[model samples]
Structures are given as C-alpha cells and as structure tokens.
Target chain A: MNAALPILALFTLLALALGLYARRGHDMGLEGWAVGGRGFGPILVFLLLAGEIYTTFTFLGASGFSYGSGAPAYYIIAYGALAYVLGYFLLPAVWRVGQANKLVSQPDFFVHQYDSPALGVLVAIVDILALIPYLVLQLTGLGIIVSLASYGAIDKAVAIWIGAVIVTLYIVASGVRGSAWTAVVKDIMILAIVVFLGLYLPYHLYGGIGAMFAKINTAKPGFLVFPASGQSIWWFATTVLLTSLGFFMWPHSLGACFTARSANVFRKNAIALPIYQLILLFVYFVGFAAVLSVPGLKGAATNLALFKIVIAQFPPWFVGLVGAVGILTALVPGSLIAMTAATLTARNLYGLARPDAKDDEIVNVAKAFVPVIMLIAVYFTLSGSSTIVSLLLVGYSFVTQLFPALVASFFPQIGVTKQGAFAGIAAGVLMSAWLTFTGQSVGKLMPFLPQAIKDFNVGIIALALNVIIMVAVSAVTARKALQPARS
Target chain B: MRPVYWIALIPFVGILAGPVLHNHVHPFILGMPFPLGWVSVWLVITAVLMAVLYALDPANAGE
Candidate 1:
C-alpha cells in the first residue's frame, strides 16, 4: 500500500501550510521577504541558521561518509563546532554591519564594504553559481529519499518535481520566514528520529554502542581512526579548517545571519548551536551501525545507510515517518538556498543593470526568480548533468575563495582595494575549477611534495593563492593610491 | 580583541589536535570511537566555553 508515500505527501503539505501561515502578519516587501524585516529574535534566528547549516547533506552525506570512509567523517562534526565558535564573534559583526547598512543579500556586504557595485556583481555571480549545485544536490537527495522510503513505488523524477514546486510555492509566499517556519518542524522531527535510530540500531544489532565499535574494529581494522596516509590526520585537520571558514561564506548562511533583530541573538546562538551540532554524532552512529548490520552499500549507495537499515528492521509506518523527516530536511534548506539565489539575482545582478528599478519592481523580480531557479535546479537534477555534479564537489572551495576578501573587509589596515579583491577572487575561483576539472589533488599536482603535505585538502592551496594574490595586489594598488595621481 | 576572548582558542586546539593526540581507536570514551568521542567531548567543551564567554564579555552584558 506504500504508506511511506502518503506520509511523505502529508508532511510536505503541512510544511507548505506553515510557510503560508508565516506570511499572515508580515509585510512581503523586498526587505521583508529577503531578511524577514531584520526582526527575528534569538530562537527564530537559531533555528533558521540551523535550518540552513544542517541540510539533506547532513542526513545523507554525513552518514554516508561515515559508512564509507570511517574516521574522516569526524571532520564534519569538528568543522561545525568550530564554525560556530567563529560565528560567536563573526556573525554578530555581520549582523551589526547588516543592520546599519540595510544589507539584505550576502553580496551587498562586499558591495558596501568595498564601495564597489562591480564587486557585488562578481559576488552575486559566484554565489548563484555555487548555489545551483548546492540546490541541485538537495533536490537529488530528496528524490533518493522519497523513492527509497516508498519501497520503490514512486518515481525519483516525479518526487523531485513535487519537492521543487513545494519549495518554490512556500518561498515565493513567505521567503525567509517560510524556511524558518518549516525549520521549526524539521529540527524537532530530525532530533527525535536521529536519536532514536542512532540508539536503537546499535543496541538492537550489536548489543550496545561499545560492542558495535569493537566488532567493527575487529572486522575492518584501522577504519575507526585516521590512517597514516591518504585521508590522514593532516587531511582531517586541514579539511576541517577549510570547511569551517567556508561554512558562513555560503550566501544563504550569511543571509540567514541578517534575519536576526539583535547582534546578541547571534552571540546567544553561538553558545547553543554547537550543542545542536552534536546531533551529527548520532548521525555518525547510524552510519556506523549500518556498516555491520546492512553491508555491501558501495559508492553512491552508501548514502542509503540510514533508510536501508530502517526498512529492513522496522515496519512501513515507521519508514514513512523517517521519509517524512527526510523530506523536510531537503525542503527547508532548498527553500532557503533558492530564496538567497533569487534575491541575489534580482537585487545585485538585475538591479545593477536597471538602476532605475523601483523597490517594488525588484521584489517582484525576486519572486519571479524563485520558480525560475527551482526549474533550473529540477532540470539539472533530472538530466543528471555530470558537469554540475562535478562542480558540486568544488562548491566549498569555490566559495571559500571569498573568505580572504571577506575577512580583509573587516580590517582596513590590510588596505585591500576593490581591484585586488576582484582579481584575487577571480583567480581563486579559476584555480579551484581547474584543479577540480583536471582531477588534480595536491599529490597529483606536485608529486615531489611530502605525503603529509600532499594529503592536505586542495582547497587550502586555492585559498592560499587567494590570500597571496589579494595581499600582493593590495600592496601594489595601495602604493599606487599613495603615489602621484596620474591617469 | 580582549584577553578573555582568547579562551575561544581552546576548542580549536583541542579538536584539531586530534590527529596527534587521540588518533587511536582503543580507549573509547562513552562507547564511541577514539576520534568520534574526541570530537563529541570538544563539542561540549565548546558550548561551555561559549557560555562562559557570554557571561564574562561586556558586549553581551546589557542584553
């Protein structure tokens, strides 16, 4: 009878209702739609940020990585905790600047800070480029979740189409508030489901958590800890460092920060969100439990670790519940990413072209972009474009290029000029793209380097190039500014 | 930045140093792998550290 399909459908409808309900008492202007009028308090801000940070990636990607690679997955947990440590200081400053300047999009910060609309345009392009793959990844996960949970009764493409339409509907109606409302349901459901599955699976299968690890250690030696080479300690450490910096650089996360009313809300969130991040630990538990109980899930199939075990052990009704929660995981973050990309397009990209465009016109344009972006994501999802899927791997590194310019903006002493910022970012993005497309790792790029250095995440190399280029160009341009004024 | 704010470095140090400090699989803390338990412990430490920072910092004092 496929009870999971009905459960999934009902939850999707409920999320849409909550999203629409969120718009009842609020204005839906450009300011209201983009940043929720900059009036979200501590709890809403926390859940909204959590909603963006913990996406379908956390549910499938985190668990799947643990099932496949073992200890390297611990970097996922480490990076989030450290990123919030950064958010403790970083987000409050962003919120303060955002409030003062009426900033709505992430690129607006760069535009104002550097006093360069051109830089804003560049940022907007990079953001949307980075976001497309991210959005497609979420939709792809949604299809996989729905089809797998439904016992193969539903088609993946139909599930993706339905998910995309629902996200667009809510986001156009309520914008960031829609994502926030859905997040409230999502956070509660995920916490309950993940904790239950994480505990029940290990104890039910292997007598206890400790026993599971002991058996896994005996079965797959050295899988429980970092190896001396390949994805070693160095890789874990550097990857954690790269991802933490890149976390807030995501346009959606930065945009989420602007939704808060007070700077202190971020400060308070920083204290609690790391605790929230501990949820990933249980996710890892679920992945580890699957390694022994439900084996042979290789490559991409590894992502089904959570669902496969659940369906094998539990009834259809419980599987439906898990599927319902999985749908929220995709929809909440998908709505936020779509909204961020649309606002970036309408305001920074289109608004720059038509400077005379009114605020009402810009908001309408943003709303118009919501479905367009969703359709593009849907097309890419169904087409199975290898180009974009490969781009998804470098999405983090591509956006991390902005970190040097972003942090430099906060400190005027560095004197990073607009030209320098532009050149550094362009070069960094190009470097990462070339490396990714060519399938070049640090080891492959420079065979003479030590294995430890070779094992470092290639993103660090891109970021280093970004910083070096930024500093050199800034130095040259800064001196040029100080010297005689000759055109 | 104030001197007290330096306390935030403790989590970064504790967690990133896992490769060198707690890379072994044995001696699982709370029934998890050594590295997994290591990160779990640091997550708690980070939360506690932030709470302390929130209390001691003057910027958050009024709010």
Candidate 2:
C-alpha cells in the first residue's frame, strides 16, 4: 500500500464510526431503517438532500463532460437548480400526500393515491430496474476515484467492491439515519474542498475563468457555444428538458422526502437546494478548467479527470483529503442507493410476494438485501461497457415512464384506471426499448413521419407517447366517470 | 395568485436564458468575480420570488 492508503483508511474508519453511532437510537424496524422513522429535521434533511444530489458523477462526470464538451457542460449546473425550483411546487404536494398516507416509497404513494397495487408493483419494478444502472454509475465512479488515488495499485474491481462493502455495512446497520448523519459531514467537506479548489485551481492554472474560456474558445469554439456543430438544437433542448424532468423522479430523492420531519422541511430544502447547486456550478467549471489546463488528456478514462487534476496539482496529503472527500461523496449516495434498492425490494417485491410479512421481518429482509444489491451493482460496474452518464441516462429514460401515473394520481377526478396506466406504461417502455436498441428514429422505423420529427430522444418521445396513451385509454374506459357531474 | 409560479420562473428563466445570453453581457457584483454571475443572480431572484410567492400563496402560510 502507498503512504496515502493509511490516511484514506483513517478517514473511512471515522465515517464508519459516525454512521454506526447514529444508528444507536432507532429501532430495527422497517420505518426506522428505511425512512429514519419519519423524523428528520431541516438540517438533516438538507444534508441528506445535498448528499444525494452531489454524487461521484458531479465530481468526475461533470468535469469530464466540461473537459470534453466545454461550456455547454454548464447545463449540468443549470438543470440542478431548475430541478429544485420545480421541486418547490411539485414536492410539497408529494410531501403532504406522503404525510397523510405515510407513504414509504414512490410506488407506495402512487398505489395509495390511485388505489392500484399493480401500478405500485410496476413503479417498483421500474424503479429498481432504473436504479440499478444508477447505482452502478456511482460504483463505477467510486472505483475510478480509488483506482486513481492508489495510482493503479488497487484494481478497479477491487476498489469498487471494497467501497461498496463499506457503504453497504453502514447502510444496513443504520439505514437512512446512517446515510443522513454521514451526509452532514460529507456535504460540508465536499462544499469546502470543491469551492476552495474551484477558485484556486483556475487562477493557479489559467489566471481566471475568463482567461480560461478565452483559451478554450480559440482552441475549440464548439465547446463554448450552445448546440455545437455536432450536437443539434433539438437534441440539446430535449436532453435538458428530459434531464430536468427526471431529476426528482429518482427513488432516492423520494426516499429522502419521506424522511423529512415536516412539509416545511421539504420546502426549506427546495429553497436552499439551489444554494447547493451554486456550489455545483464551481464543480462544473472545474470541468471546463480541466479542458484548458489538462489538454490531450481526453479519452484517457473520463472518470478519473478530477482525481488526475488533483494529483497533478495538489500535494499527496491534500490529495488524500480530496480522496477522502471523493470517497465520502460516493459513500453517501452509494449507501443511500443500496438502502433505497433494498427498501424497494423488501417493501415492494417481498411484501407483494408475501403480504403477511411482519414489519421487523421486512426490515430484516431489507437489511439482508443491502449487500446482495451492492454485489449486483459491483458486478454491473465491473461488467458494463458504457460511461457513467450513458448508464444514468438509460436509467432516467426508464424511470420517466412512471411520470404519467404519478402526475395523474394527484387529481382524484382524473381516475386513471389501473389497466390504462399499465397499458401506457407497457407501450411507453416498448417504444423506449425499441428506440434505444434500434438506433432508428420512430419515423425512420415507420417511414411515415418527417425527418425533423424523426430523430427524437427515445425517452422524451416515449414519455409523450405514454401520456397520450394513458389519457386516451383513461378517457375511453372511464368515459362515464368523465361525464359532467349531475347537479 | 400564486407567487410560487412566478418564483419558479426565475430559475426557469435562468436555465433558459443563461446559456442563450452567456456569450454577451458579463454582469458583475461590486467589482468582485461572481463566478456564478447570471446563475447566481437568477438563483437569488428565484429565492426572493419564491419567498414572496410563498408568503402570498395563503396555502403556504402554515395552515
């Protein structure tokens, strides 16, 4: 082991101790394990929310994208802020409904509102399916950071497995409280390191942001402009819109919502989250700065961009701290994702499979599944061929199908029939899969639509088709229910 | 009557306008380098707008 390994080990041990300590008070029950017994105040909620939002992707992927694409990479920062603003209105409704119903998962809310177990199962399955890829993305990021920090001494697969095991233990032991409490420390360290480094790195490297951009512009004008020549305007708009829509739909965010002590906590989180995003703006700039500072480093393992920069510029000791921060970033979300997946499987699949299961038994089952899920995630992380963003987008596209059922449930009058919801979900899913695998636009596939409308994002177009089908089927089936109310 | 709608618009507009207008008009605050610049201004505006909207939307008045 290198000299830094001891420092990294010390940091990891401290985090684990804190996580275990936080688990002391809560009972080993489903509610306690999954939702922290529904008792998180604003501070904890804020930290948890912030932690969930800033993953390894934000650290590595944003910089890599910025490094690769240039200014348009700022959209990552832009969309995060937009997500919170959207949540300010959208989440309160969800918070109130969840509060009233004691909703545990996103599917629980959907099924509770619509009175449809089938829809709940569909949401759960889709959530787990979508979440696996995301979890793998986080794992892959963790592996990259570890591999970089260890200077190839630690194998990527071994690094991912080691990180996964540590996180899985904390989550299984402490659950959401474990994740939340650690998140408090994780967020502070991340914010401090990122802000300090974001400012220091640019001036140290290229004098200033303006100077950096100037060099980048001369070298690669496409990076500075919107919808650069290779990327079309439609693709940009659709990607941004889809990314914004799918941001809050992640099951982990919903899991965080249920842990909020009150609706006001959720609201405060929404209001304060953009401040967090402002910090993320610096993280995004680190990406652009990386391009100018570290040229010809492209195609050299995009996931290691941030670690590479830190190692090149900062000292070994400081690199250790940055490594700790990067590891913590992965740890917080990694634990939560494992917890969310476990909870999803336990509550949705196990519970659905065996309705008579006890609460304690369910909690135990969830705890047991944490490591299993992490192993699966580790397997995929090692096995997958694509980058983190590609995996995440595929997952996002899958989860977006749930939007119609979720939105429709808010209006009691709409009364989307279970059959209709499933039909829409099925059609949307098939369309998305076809579009994803075939690489041919629906227009090209059908040979009927204009070229402009042909090359659509599978997710956006599929989501649209889902909404249309759901509305049509609901209207036709519930036509009598849709009639004007008798006076 | 919900200011929340208007409040949401600040960031909404920023995300839409910041990139479009990024090439022109670099706004500064008190001669300091506002790294966020337009995004930060938009966030502050959005926060104020949201706060105002929350105050006006009686539903948000802690019923």
The numbered model that scores best in DockQ is 1
lDDT of 2 by residue, A107-179 (tens): 7876776666777788888888888988888888887877777677778888788888788888888998888
Docking quality tier of model 2: acceptable
On lDDT, the candidate that comes out on top is 1
Q: For candidate 2, lDDT tens digit of each residue in B1-63?
A: 354466566667555565444543234332212323565566666666666666666666651
Question: Which candidate number would show the highest TM-score if scored against the true structure?
Answer: 1
Question: Model 1, range A141-204, lDDT digits (tens) per residue?
Answer: 8998999899999899999999999999999999999999899999999999999998999999
C-alpha root-mean-square deviation, each candidate:
2.6, 3.5
Candidate 2 residue pairs that clash: none
Task: Indicate the worst ten consecutive residues by lDDT in candidate 2 chain A.
Answer: A478-487
**What tier of docking accuracy does candidate 1 attain?**
high
Model 1: fraction of the reference interface contacts it also forms: 0.89
